[model samples]
Target: MNSLYHGSELCEVDADGNVAVPAFLEDAFAPETSPEIVVAKHQADDCLIGYGRAHLSTLAERAERRRVAEEERGEEARSHYRRMRGTFGLSERIKRDGRGLRIPPAMRHLGRIDDLALFVGAGDSFEIWNPQLALESDDEHFRALAEFRLRMRGTKTAGVH
Candidate 1:
């Protein structure tokens, strides 16, 4: 149900490994018949994250601004850049059509995605996963969210005089 970046879709990959785009999502895409998509394997998990080229551009701009700001604070942003380069280097630009998308063989192998695929919404992008891995990741994601909230609260409390 997370529509921010992903839609709730359980699509089956046909023999050709093509996944059909859900009508709701397909209708929401830009007018361009084929948009560039960047598919990456999650560094910490067994899933793939897809980033529309448009989204990736915007993200890069935002990240650059943040990196400059971090630089002023004498904080190293190189690690973040390294992670991004690693992911983007492994990414392939695939044409997205109304039918859905064709997961390149390399990306599929990188994520261990075989037949059944699940698309889950991410804030700025969406993730693709095999059903079982998706389910396991959901549990992990939920648990991480809780711990993250607690960590934030602790940081805020400690900052207060």
Candidate 2:
């Protein structure tokens, strides 16, 4: 499974809505075997999700597995399966040119993306967010992050008596 992504990085969105992806993540898309990328709504968060061909396929497979298993269960499970299927279908593939990949309209609106966006690296997928929204979310997000760290820190004595 792809690890959950976190944090933010600044990136420019061009006139045509294309944005350059961070070079560090280029390899993740290689499995997709296409320069084209897909942008869609993130299920659990207020952000835009980006997927390469391979990653999308992996997501499809997982959804399919859930669907098949749900089929054996009943109506409720089936409904969930249908919803998952529907979500995958909403994905839009981005076209790459000399500049970068263009963000699709649906995703653009969903993320409120404009001239500038913040690309956040999540292990298996990345999220694109409008700069202002990102800034607002970061305050709350970072506070939670700090709390998490504090909980995880081991207590130690500063000095011996």
Candidate 3:
């Protein structure tokens, strides 16, 4: 029987980046708990984005929209579109070899993934991040948000929109 997977799970990846999928998440990719997963680079940091066949189809649709949006745009927009395409174009599809989820070499290198891995759930999707990188990236985000909030508060007092 299959079930839905939710919540965040911190997991470890071997030197080869193959991670043992927790029982909770195992069913998330059910019928074949070990289907081939599509891996792409995370936009915010050196993290890998992974999803099963079902979710990847949805992502492909969104990517198509972004690709089409840049057709009549300038160089910068075109570059951004190209990057988006390349990220997905270069993505790797890894399958579970019965032992664990095999994180492909290309994705592992791109995301700087090593022994320590953090699997974070994002609703229907999930992110694979190197623990150290995730910590540093999260701290930077917090700092940036704090500074932006402070600036906004000051602007409010000055009647700035």
Best by lDDT: 1
TM-score for predicted model 3 compared with the true structure: 0.69
Compared with the true structure, all predictions reach lDDT values of: 0.66, 0.63, 0.64
> Per-residue CA lDDT of candidate 2, range 4-110, in tens?
44454556777667777655455445443566767888776677888665576687677778777877766367566556744676578776554367887777878
Question: Over the stretch 46-161, how does candidate 3's per-residue lDDT look in tens digits?
Answer: 78877775666566677777666766554346666666665567688887666478888888898888875666655666677765566555577633433343354342212213
Off by over 4 Å in 3: 1-5, 32-34, 70-77, 139-161
- Give the per-residue lDDT of model 1 (tens digit) for 1-161: 21246455666776666888755456556675247677888767787887666666675776678778888989888866876675668788887765778988988888777776666666767777765554444587643433443344342222223
2 or 3, greater by lDDT:
3
Error of 1 at 125 (Å): 1.6
Task: For residue 158, give model 3's deviation from the true position in Å.
Answer: 40
Model 3 residue 59 lDDT score: 69
- The stretch of ten residues in a row with the least summed lDDT in candidate 2 is 152-161
- Error of model 1, residue 105, in angstroms: 1.2
Residue pair clashes in candidate 3: none
Task: Please estimate how well model 1 matches the true structure, expressed as its whole-model Cα lDDT.
Answer: 0.66
By summed lDDT, the worst window of 10 consecutive residues in model 3 runs over: 152-161
